[model samples]
Target: MSTSTMNPETADRSRRALAAEQAASLAATNDWAHVDKDRVHRDWHELYGEIAAAITAGAQPRDEAVQELVDRHYAIASRFYAPSRDAYLGMALLYAEDDAMRDWHNSYHPDMVEFLGAAMMRYAETRL
Candidate 1:
């Protein structure tokens, strides 16, 4: 990992490329692609990014706002992943297991990986 911080412009550009690549990878393997990657990334960064900031500021996984964020997380992920609860949980786990995913979250906030996992589990237990 590089020890440099990404400026907003650079980060946005990098995120777009990464999103497009991941969409292509998913499509190549699964026979479908999410064409609205910019929208997806925009929402993910704006909404989920806010949640990560809240977590960093000491929000608990059980918080109502946090749970709502988890709901939004599941919804957005369904565009790129699967819509089932099982797939949602699997993705929650993958955030921790995948180096790129985990690193990307950590890049924005240090507590993000575990915080998001806990929030997703809580959401699954309470909602799904």
Candidate 2:
């Protein structure tokens, strides 16, 4: 549950694995065209970790700091496809409900999937 104390090597491995997995998933969905897989992986790797840390620090979904992070997340996602408010909220639902996606997010923090889903939904409601 405490990601702050997660070993650097292990974290690096996790990030690399998630990045590759995400890139492959995007490619499979035909959404990787013109998308820099490496960059996408890197950005997501950093962003996910940062969001995990913020959540661990007790930032709520509607908190300013958490919202800022979600902004970055939205921007990164927009590179692949523009999302309407409903679509973004739907993504939050997918992250929380999809076993694979939930497992992937929980790899960073036990509460990652729930926290991220809430944050994304809040972002969609307020900003998207």
Candidate 3:
């Protein structure tokens, strides 16, 4: 078996790329009216728990794990029905102010805010 060591920079870039891809996928999907919000929230909590456990188990690095969490969070949020562009934008704006969002942004080595914002803007454009 061969093992490779990833430098911090490469790992950071990979995590950001993953987040971007996830955001784009979420944006591209057209259906949302049938999503169950409560179920999504519960799933998010479960995913977060899994990530935390993975971190504790050394299965993944914290940065990568947190990026996954953010990706899942956005994917779930993207499934919600927003009646108008204003409503969608309002949710994004509210996300910007959310404590968990801020914590995720702070935890990443790269500029997660910029990356996530770009993805979110693309999501908005797809809706328009």
Candidate 4:
């Protein structure tokens, strides 16, 4: 409760989280138009957790369950990124090569990003 007892790192993280939530709301209100930022983020978070679990369980990129999760992932992604082969392919490559994106994905699990990248490319190849 007191500043002396509070962990600075935990307090900083809480502050950053609140700031991010406010920023998301402001973006949606100012320019996002019809997009529901909260809903999209919540759904994406759920899907990412599930996808990470599947990958940790040793589900291959082309596994039936993994494919289904990847499809759901793409649908969510398409809400922000226009649904198309190029967009999906770009996202796949981004996940694979972008340092910031890789760090975010790796925060979920060590291999989650690579697994999602593979599934993204596979989905693009087969569905797009």
Candidate 5:
């Protein structure tokens, strides 16, 4: 394994810690008054699973079908924050570079984070 890559146990711990920190931050800034947390969670889980299946089926990041998936991903994300083009690309960077986020995404498929990041980048550049 690469020196930069954490071991599974360490990665899990790191992910949990990061999640806690993020949740705290989000709670402080976002009003959760009307949101259905469970439904949003389910939507994200379903979307991630679909994206994973697309990757496993050899879909390229710029493929039309893959772009459709990215569209849904962006729409869902916009419910929380509608990012500018640069912000969306920055998020793509996080998907591929953040250890905890990358590992969480990769759990769906070995290349899920990279695939999704590329797709998101493409979507941002061309569509957004």
Candidate 6:
């Protein structure tokens, strides 16, 4: 199948829905307080590198990679921290505020939404 087969708009909508659900699930949990900050940061960096590599490799369909990254981060975050809607929203906002993240987000034109959605989901999963 071609990349064109995966409508960017539709994929973005699906990703956003997933993110919202994950965020809500996280909000319902209570495990964010004990999160290991250093470890989560390290893992985030590692995953970021992997994502960069995937893009560099010219991977045909990057959504899967994005999804996996999102899933992994969410799992890690949920395991590490306490559930707080404000904290989750803050983290997501922080990413948008960072220059590096902005660059990374801009690097992939049509896929940026997917990447952001994945990141949000990952953050949400941390609460679970």
Per-candidate clashes, comma-separated: 0, 0, 0, 0, 0, 12
Model 1, residue 98: distance off in Å is: 1.0
The lDDT of model 5 is 0.73
Off by over 4 Å in 4: 1-31
Backbone clash tally (model 3) = 0
- Compared to the true structure, candidate 1 yields what TM-score? 0.70
User: Which ranges in model 3 have alpha carbons more than 4 Å from their true place?
Assistant: 1-38, 42-75, 78-80, 104-111
Worst 10 residues of 6 by lDDT: 1-10
What lDDT does model 6 reach? 0.53
Candidate number with the higher lDDT (3 or 5): 5
Candidate number with greatest lDDT: 2
Q: Pick the candidate with the highest TM-score.
A: 2
Model 3 scores worst on lDDT over the 10 consecutive residues at 1-10
The count of residue-pair clashes in candidate 5 stands at 0
lDDT pick, better of 4 and 5: 5
Regions of model 2 farther than 4 Å from truth: 1-30
Candidate 2 or 6, higher lDDT? 2
RMSD (Cα, Å) for all candidates, in order, is 10.6, 10.9, 12.3, 13.1, 7.6, 8.3
Predicted candidate 4 versus true structure: per-residue lDDT over 5-110, tens digit per residue: 3355644453454345445655765755567889998997888888878877889887778888888887876565444565455565556566898888788879
Per-residue lDDT, model 1, residue 20, is 57
lDDT of each: 0.68, 0.74, 0.47, 0.67, 0.73, 0.53
1 or 2, which is superior by lDDT?
Answer: 2
Residue pairs in candidate 5 whose N, alpha carbon or C atoms collide under 3 angstroms: none
Task: Count backbone clashes in candidate 4.
Answer: 0
**Cα shift from native, residue 30, model 1 (Å):** 7.0
* Model 4: colliding residue pairs: none
Ranked by lDDT, top first: 2, 5, 1, 4, 6, 3
How would you encode candidate 6's per-residue C-alpha lDDT over 1-112 as one tens digit per residue?
2212335564455446446655666576553445677888888677766666665666432366655765665566557443354445444544455568666655654454
